[model samples]
Target: MPFDEPSQIPRPPRRVAPDDRPVADRLADIRARIDKAATIARRAPAAVTLIAVSKTHPAAAIEPLLTAGQRDFGENRVAEAQEKWPALRERFPDTRLHLIGQLQSNKARDAVALADAIHAVDRSSLVTALSRAMEQEDRRPDCFLQVNIGDEPQKGGCALPDLPALLAEARGADLPVAGLMCLPPAGLEAAPYFALLAKIARDHGLVGLSMGMSDDYETAVTLGATHVRVGSALFGARA
Candidate 1:
């Protein structure tokens, strides 16, 4: 039997599902909060870049946000990013991927390939590893030197006093030291830490500053953060 001609082919009507709470509603709520935060900081809303941290959340959860026009997403673990990036890239090619976790030297190549920016380059060895990896891959991802502004030994960042020298070395290596990144101590106000980071970046002529997470992003913006990493607030608590 001959198949039906193109003009005679039958088509099924598209089915549209309804939800009590639209995705835009959630995004509106988030945008409102971000607006309030920006206003409180006296910062132009456009100055603060919100990076939707999507670590541990499945791609399905993120698909809605992507559909809602959120283009920046951050992940903490290299292994998780390595696993998630390929599929997410296929699905959302325009989405920007950021590595906001401590990066080990061994994972440098994969991180360079998958991340649009690495927000956690803490030490010279890691930078060297990244430089070598980028050379091998013939790629260079934007990088932020994580600074231990709180001076917390437990944190994975370079000490504050060590920053200038590190920045010089990173620049010398021909790596793009995009800016500074930091994690303030728990229960501590983030403004001072953010201010300090901004000053350091200015002194070195670096422009990018990746600071603040969900808890202290407003404070960070007030202190001149160009980028803020927000996770749980954007995507419900991650297990």
Candidate 2:
């Protein structure tokens, strides 16, 4: 479900109930987990940001979480986000959007226009394109250099050897290089990969680590993940 493969875009799994109460409670539980994980790691809970990945969910399914005081939301497809977020943003002006999916260089302008942060800037071409768009449009979204930490060929990260250069390029372009992101190979022990990403960020003197998803976010928190993207655990199974 990595962002680069659009043909394999994840389909929504199942419909969640219309009731808002569960959504409120669900967020509270997630917040508790985040707090516990942060405490165990001896880091302040407020240091980590939880981004509800509302990829395939419509605005109705998303609003309850917003009402629960979840301000940061993430989306995979720019087009899908375009369809849903404008109305929602009109209603909730403080909502911050993160592009937690792979991005194409061609869509740089739109991505720059829509996202508060882009968590998938892994290549030089994208850095150049995004820099131009941001300059022309007067928008500079925070950028994360997605690393193929597991060295998976199909993933959208800049390979390990290329990360430093890419980071340097992103900085050179004046794109706000905020952090490093990765998708450790699914079903494997994720801690090592998460640890590796944190180390890379440290080696590069970067402050953010956008690792973890629904399954292993707590483990990631232990290893210093600044942002964890959760969808199913907060919203229920996709339809």
Candidate 3:
């Protein structure tokens, strides 16, 4: 059950059946779930920040959750977030935006301007781009070095073998690395991946672990996820 060995990590307990209810009710449920998981892990619930992934959903769709007091949110694309969040942030000035998708080097400036945290800092070129952007913008968004936990080819994360070098490069450039992020391969038990990610973060003395989505957030919480990117569970199925 040691975190370093993903295969030895036990499968997460089966979650209850989905709750089909209003947004506020679902939001409450997810929070309660996080609290329970954190308690079970002997961690404080406040340690987990729930990031409602607002990608693809329109601003109108996001407002209700904002009204319901969900402060942190994640978006995939810089342009979409640029178009959707400015007015929303104007109203809810405390809202923290997280860029949870792959970021292009070309969009580094925009991402630095918009996101409170940039979760997919994978490559050396991107680290340089973001560092330069941060200097120009006078903003240092928390950067999470994404580790391809499953080593999947199509994923947008630094391979496990490459992480130490990438982490060094990012720190050498002074990219305020908050922690690590990852997406466990879909349709499999997620605990092992979460555990693996937790191990990596601990190995590097990083405190932030931004893993978990709607389906497996509780497991992520129990495994020490500081930030959980939840979308469908909060907003319902996307079109």
Candidate 4:
């Protein structure tokens, strides 16, 4: 009888180990949810940017997420961010930090130094301060013009009608206006407001749209959000 040929070797499927589960697992879970949401919107998952909101959460929490390949983090309070950024930066040098809080004119200098981008430039005074601070520090921080989409008196954005003038002033002062940010009214549909901000940004030739949060980021992404600030969803409920 003729000698039988040796059988070809069989390859085993790769397995994800338990020790490698935390970060990648968390990221995969979040990405899956985002994908489902995008499908509902009839858009690609890449259309939305998930900005892991790390405000109030310590560096301990942030490290795990970073290890899982998360590069973008958002902080709401300038003071808190200022205190946390140095250590975080030292640890994760490549991470991008965003200041998603209400920025004050007084904190412009420090904010410029700490944040890769500031998402709350809503007033002429604040813009002027930021411009001066950037000149003084010789560093121009990327910024967005926050619009009071809901026009709620208690909110911290410029009124809808005032955005044009504010944009003009920011441009005049040499402020780098990257895009627009907004907080939609609570208990109401946010899509309209998000759409309005998107329109305004497009009209001004701006690109970034930072909107939505833990509760409604999917909707924001559907509405063409370039950046979504998600805190509670990633970090668990706020304490």
Candidate 5:
């Protein structure tokens, strides 16, 4: 059977073994799901970039996936990524690191120096900081303007009412605004939020839609996600 077919996507077994599968196997499983979702959406699988979120995972646990040929990785903290990725990248120099957490303005310089993509450009201060950092370092990582899709107060995304102005500020500062990122409120259906983000990206003529996580990535791909940030599914449950 063709692997990209919806029917070919693997389903959970009736009585599964423990989650002791190697990282390579997990990566393959996620890739197959992405392919299946893309095919169902009539999109080329290559259009979706799978970012294996490596936050809180030690380098030892991440190396197997690296050896398995996974290149795009995501991290949550600047200091943690600074500490672990330097040595890992020296060994595997092609790894693309994504800063997937809320970034403080003070760490903009470090983030610009470290990440190939910044997925949390939510505020004007961050936009100013990142623009200056990019000029000083002469490096421009792709940036995603995160949106608070569900109007959740606790999240680190630009409120919907303020997004246009924020996007304008980011553009005025010469930040490479690639697209939008969002985290839908937990325990709620994510498709609406994913669709909303995709529409917003289209309305603004932006191309990237960095949405989805381990549980909802398949849905995300079908809804036009260009990048899926999956962690637990790829690295296994963190202790």
Candidate 6:
């Protein structure tokens, strides 16, 4: 994807889940589960980074979690994050923003400037754009190469066959390739996928494994996930 010409990536339609809860209680429950999973795996409780996915929620919805001491949050779209995070960060400067959705090469600059880590870097053109963006913006965020572990056609990750070359491309461009990221095929037992992603990262000498979400984060933790993105479980349903 050498200079494929950047274009705007449309945001997906919003789908809200039902109900909500006190962020503190929900956050506490999620952390307790994470700690239990980590202990079971003989991994340190501190080894996992819990990323609260706050994509469609409002600033007010997020404030409680911030006050509750969650430092890392994830957004699915760059535009939404740009609009939301600045004011939030103005109030709480220590928060780290993560871009956890399919990113367009066009938004690479904005993502580079805003995110502390990008969890979806799958193509060469995105690699080029992000590398340039980091240089021009004078900010380099950690990157994770998204692998379509289940090889789903409608998903955002790079196909398994393309990963090695893509990794090389990302590194050659001086993108700080932190590790691999993936989304298992939905509605399936996700353990195999998580294990596969961990193996891929291990094979590459990459330590970060950005897998797991509200439903299967514990399984992901058992498989060596360094980061778990939990949303509904932390914020109740979406609302």
- How do all models score by TM-score? 0.86, 0.91, 0.93, 0.85, 0.92, 0.91
lDDT of 5 by residue, 138-224 (tens): 999999999888788888899887888899999999999999999977767778788878888888889999999988899999999
Off by over 4 Å in 6: 1-21
Q: Tens digit of lDDT per residue, candidate 1, span 17-119? A: 3334665575666566667777887877786678989999888888888889888889999898777778878878998999999988999998988888999
Query: Highest lDDT among the candidates is held by which one?
Result: 3
Better of 1 and 5 by TM-score: 5
List the RMSD of every prediction in angstroms: 16.8, 6.1, 2.8, 15.7, 6.9, 6.9
Instruction: Please estimate how well model 2 matches the true structure, expressed as its whole-model Cα lDDT.
Output: 0.88
Query: What are the clash counts of all predictions, listed in order?
Result: 0, 6, 0, 0, 0, 0
Highest-scoring model, TM-score: 3
Clashing pairs in 1: none
Error of 6 at 11 (Å): 29
Better of 1 and 5 by lDDT: 5
Give the alpha carbon lDDT tens digit for every residue of 1-239 in model 4: 11222233332442222333465575767678778887888888887778899999988888888888888899988888877778878878998889998988999999887788999999988988999999888888788999888768999999877888999999899888889999987667666777777778878899889998877777788777888887766777665
- Model 3: residues >4 Å from true position, as ranges? 1-5, 8-20
CA lDDT of every candidate = 0.80, 0.88, 0.91, 0.81, 0.90, 0.88
The 10-residue segment of model 5 with minimum total lDDT is 1-10
Location of the lowest summed lDDT over 10 successive residues in candidate 2: 1-10
Q: What value does the lDDT take at residue 101 in candidate 3?
A: 93
Cα error, candidate 1, residue 80 (Å):
0.8
